[model samples]
Target: MGSHWSAASRARALASATRLWRGSLSQPLLTWALVLLTVVASVAVVTTGNWVPVSVLILIELLGAFLLRLRGMVVLCSVIAAECVGMVVARSEAFNPGEMLVQGVSIVALLAFAFHREQLGLQGAPGGLMLVDLRDRLAAHGRIPRLPAPWRVDSALRAAYAEAFSGDFVVASTAERGTLLEVAVVDVSGKGQAAGVRSLLLSGSFGGLLGAMPPEEFLPAANDYLLAQDWDEGFATAIHVSVDLSTGEYWIVSAGHPPAVQLHAGSGRLDIIDSIGAPALGVVSDLRCVPVTGRLLPGDTLMLYTDGVIEVPGHDVEMGIDRLMGAAERMLSTGRGGAEAVLAAVRASEGDDRALVLVHRDQS
Candidate 1:
């Protein structure tokens, strides 16, 4: 009876988490996948007339705590508790008291990796980036009007992310009808006032050309703005995208930037969106942005970021891209939804100045 009750309780809790996060990604799909796998293993404790697998489930749950913040913790405990209860009730012939005790200690040890506090002392901060809270001061320019009547963008971080001013401005824009016009996510090379200035000039030129110029000419317009500047402080990497929301089709031109990854929601497969184009902005006058086109369905997401997310001291660019692709594939199998969850997983493992912008359509 006790073991049966335990299984019932564990099943209930897992069901709740599944229902709550059904619509969107609540955690990294990897973590969720592990949780499900372990839960299935625990259920086997009852049917197989064995409880040995529960020990394995506990270890997997503990490892999960490292990948995700709080959800991992909850799922780990729920599985252990469910097994404990079910063992008492179903009184499965497979239940081994000695092994269960050992597994319990191991589970505690695994959870230790995710925590700062131990009986002896505290752990080092896990996240490595020296990030600034660009919240109060660096507001997205919602009040200001950017041309291109269809898209709404304000110059919020034009100074820093654009290059001239660090944490100086923000361009928060949206378009009701972005059928023909292009949208871009760009990254300045690195830190300092010079990078800030470069970011600003890039943002200014792009803002100016958004409504009028053809998508291909926008980067050149930005380059013209970069050359007009008297100072030669820094360069930037960028991806300019022309997306047709109506048809879920997009044309992307890569300019010496990290490749973007596209996740098709209907089929959790990914396409590496990469092409050889011009050098980073501000360096070349006649840079070319090689374009690639693809179609997306509702819930499909594409992510573009700088080198910060997967940088290696060695030029293991191919390896880095592969790791990111593997992570995305793992996330999809767990049934977690959306781009933000994917970004969170990448950031959790990142050791640099990570920035990501995702484009996903509303499913309504």
Candidate 2:
């Protein structure tokens, strides 16, 4: 582990240095210095009566300054090299091989610098130059968003095996001016980038729907939105929860998602709340959901999970749920592990994506 970390650190350092060096070549000061050096060498060659080489070099430099392209740099260097060879072979009365050599070397060096800079720029960032913007956008829609106080929420979404983006989970939370808190978790039908793209595209629309209407209307609205897309062989399951912060009354609705487990503060018992809505969104028209209503007292915790949490190859989902309940009961009661440990216990395989959302009602 330590050696792997050391190697990764060294790689990052090298990448950063290469990026900086490439950037410095384009800076005004260094660029002007190179241009000045070329011009001075050109003047010395001109003094030696080799006006042709001088003119060609100046023209190449001027074009380079204007275009600043990779192909342009290559052409400039080739021209300079050819000019130097011509000066050496001609042996004319005005030919100065020394000055031409200097000019050729300078142009070649500049071309090499530019080439390196371009290569570094391409290879530097992990997800390319727009990664920062991409991260900001994903964090807005995919990550666990803000929730009201007295409710500590912990959630995680992991991609399928050998994938960079998770396909199963989309968590979005919004509070309506301290009165109502809304959260939605959606799982697309597939795994990997294809499903991830759908999740990304739908995140903004789904988030808007969560907060756009009353608590009961949120699921139906989402169903309508999904049906409108009319994607062939495409469907999604989701859970939407709205909580009244003042009274602690919460309503949870689902669209073909797995049941949520609620931990009672009084009895320390775990109860699985079944899905009360219609089938998965986008499957049928005129969708309606029966919202499951419950009251969350102080110290109670509710866990919302995708099917990945309780699925194994040969065993039943009920068995997986039992395993999760057992692990969560032991971990939550002892205050040792939170949502992450619960996930570790219930995780069956890497063939599918997994997501978990834990909303703990803190004791006042």
Candidate 3:
């Protein structure tokens, strides 16, 4: 009976979530949150014939409405619905429509304008809960393989904390010609929409440019967006680049990001790219620095990485570029993972949240 009741309750909650998720699907997670809340409220009514059951639920829904995006609210609603519906169905009698209506209406009125998230009074667990849902949504999309493939992509959060959705997102889109277009990656300083919005802005503007323009043009475009956005100092550090497989041409423009590597096709010699990267795109007015370029001849390779790859502290010095380069050369010579070898080296150096992206210039 308990299992059956749980299943029915979950089904109703999912239905509510699906309904709202489709309707306000733009913020599916938020919508699910709302649906779940409704289910919880309904179930409370059936369970205790009292307001106590849904009291906590009402608070959660209100928080979602205020703190989370519409999609997040939808999913959250679905969850609450599942719980509430279960309790309510478990006790079918003594359901009072008038009392429930009043409670619902009162909460709705308290919400003021149901659509404005910033206008909400969400804090603490409520705020965190919304972030949690958004994080899950992002994680779902961040299906990074256990190992590297010819084709790959990513958009993972640093932590699963709902409040920490926007950290560093990386995506690798394959080109129609069979070569990877460019490995697009982003690093944002903080969480919340402020951080997420910036990350999104960079990803869209830069990735869009990568589709049409060459790497030389891509950097300036990313800088343009960074300078244009309303971000304070210290909120930026990213390297966006594209590796051309056919010609062995590699282009990169960085603002406080780790440099990528180019290897000698036959000798196993690796060279750290040489170019004055612009300050983290947003810091300087208009950067005079040119985009860095190099070659990865056939049988050669390139390795791109974020700061997380090098930020591990050793003794007292942070293992920055010099150490990274040495590690790469050693790995390639040892015939380890080659272009992808430095990752393991860094991980073994210290598991300091390393995210490495290696592109080898080999004919497919």
Put down candidate 1 lDDT per residue, 1-364, tens digits, no spaces.
Answer: 5443343454455455445544353455756677677667766766676435656765676556544555456566666766666665776466677766877777666666555333322221222110111121122321233333222221112232333234122232334544553566667665535354455555555665664667778777766666567455556666777766567787877767788788777777888876546787778778777788987677666666556555566758777777666666666446464444554555423333445555555344
TM-score of 3: 0.54
- Order of candidate numbers by TM-score, starting with the best: 2, 3, 1
Q: Give TM-scores for every candidate, taking all chains together and pairing residue i with residue i.
A: 0.50, 0.65, 0.54
Give the Å shift of residue 122 in candidate 2. 11
What global local distance difference test value does model 2 have?
A: 0.71
lDDT of 2 by residue, 300-332 (tens): 888888888788889998998898888889888
lDDT of 3 by residue, 288-357 (tens): 5567777766666666666665664553223466677777777765556543456555553332233566
Candidate lDDT scores, in order, read 0.56, 0.71, 0.55
Residue 301, model 3: Cα distance from true site in angstroms: 1.9
Model 3, position 339: C-alpha lDDT score: 31
Best by TM-score: 2
